[model samples]
Target: MKRIFFTLIVSVSLLFLTSSAESIDNLYLIGVVKKISHNKVTVNVKSNVCRGKKDFNISPHIKIKLEEGDFIRFQINSSTCKEKNLKILKIMKIHKPRMEK
Candidate 1:
């Protein structure tokens, strides 16, 4: 009886762990540039944070060249307020490097 109970407990724990891991979204996220303003930004992402509202604010710590259609890499802080959204860590612009003559 003890052996069976131990097995059942381990199985339940493993199931819990797997479900939690699967539901967790990545901390690092990518989004498309939607709008930009001095010290303010908005991006469109597919994260659950969207919850049907895709636009989110980029934190003041965000470092990126403000431009429409650029992709941004950022991290989300669970403890941060909703108005600030997340921090943009990098920018990926779909452009060729300027030619140097």
Candidate 2:
């Protein structure tokens, strides 16, 4: 029947739209390093949507050595990155801007 065919087409379109939307947004977080251990690092979140301190797992391949006072920003859910809530995409030390004359 034409009604059954039309319903099938609409369902398929909705499925495709939902999947595409989910893949478009990637999550990221920026925070200040509060503590650093051998296998994990704790960060005080500085984003508008998220707050408080969270601990993230340290990946073996991560090149940056974190100190307690370092401020950092990193991305999550990357292909090569693992861990549930902690993946370091990029990191750097906190800096103060100097005045230019």
Candidate 3:
């Protein structure tokens, strides 16, 4: 009986750990660029959990040029929501389809 209880506890703990890791990997957002500076960009976030204009720090290694009013999708670290450290892990611009007359 003791052995069975120990096994169950271990299984539950492993499950929690995996789920938390998956949640962190899924932290990303889609937004529109409001402004761009040397090491940061202001984005008008469109996600359900994070909506509004917020500034996100860009890594110095990422050299992508972005313009104002451009739509973008970016992945962020888990600390983004918690401590407001809004660092970008990956970033890409999204093009909108042109409307036909």
Candidate 4:
């Protein structure tokens, strides 16, 4: 009886863990450079973050280089928020790198 119960618990736990892991899929977003002032910025992303809202303050080290009216495609690999503010874990600069002679 003990062996059977232990096996059942383990199996159930495994199932839950697998299901949760599967649900945690990576999310992506494409943003347009709305404005860049000082070291801070705001972007307009479609299909991501706050119902595709405009003028969302970006977190630091997001690897974005964009000018006003320039579009930038980016994504947040992982994030954590405090008081509804997001902190980017992994980011990439979608713009092409400048050539060096």
In model 1, pairs of residues that clash are none
User: CA shift at 79, candidate 4, in angstroms?
Assistant: 10
| Backbone clashes in model 4, listed as residue pairs | none
Query: Which scores higher on lDDT, 2 or 3?
Result: 3
Q: Which is the better candidate, 1 or 2, if ranked by lDDT? A: 2
Candidate 1 residue spans exceeding 4 A from truth: 1-26, 48-62, 79-101
Per-candidate TM-scores read 0.43, 0.55, 0.65, 0.45
The residue-by-residue lDDT of candidate 3 on 1-101, one tens digit each, is 99999999999999999998777453689998888988889989898777888888987777777788878898887634555767887886566535579
In order, the Cα lDDT scores of the candidates are: 0.57, 0.67, 0.80, 0.55
Provide the lDDT at 41 for model 2: 87
Clash tally, candidates in order: 0, 0, 0, 0
Better of 1 and 3 by lDDT: 3
Report the CA-based lDDT of candidate 3 relative to the real structure: 0.80
Question: What's model 4's lDDT at 92?
Answer: 58
Regions of candidate 4 where Cα sits further than 4 Å from its true position: 1-26, 48-53, 57-59, 77-83, 87-101
lDDT of 2 at 77: 48
Q: Which candidate has the highest lDDT of all?
A: 3
* Quality of model 2 by C-alpha lDDT: 0.67
Return the TM-score for candidate 1, rounded to 2 decimals: 0.43
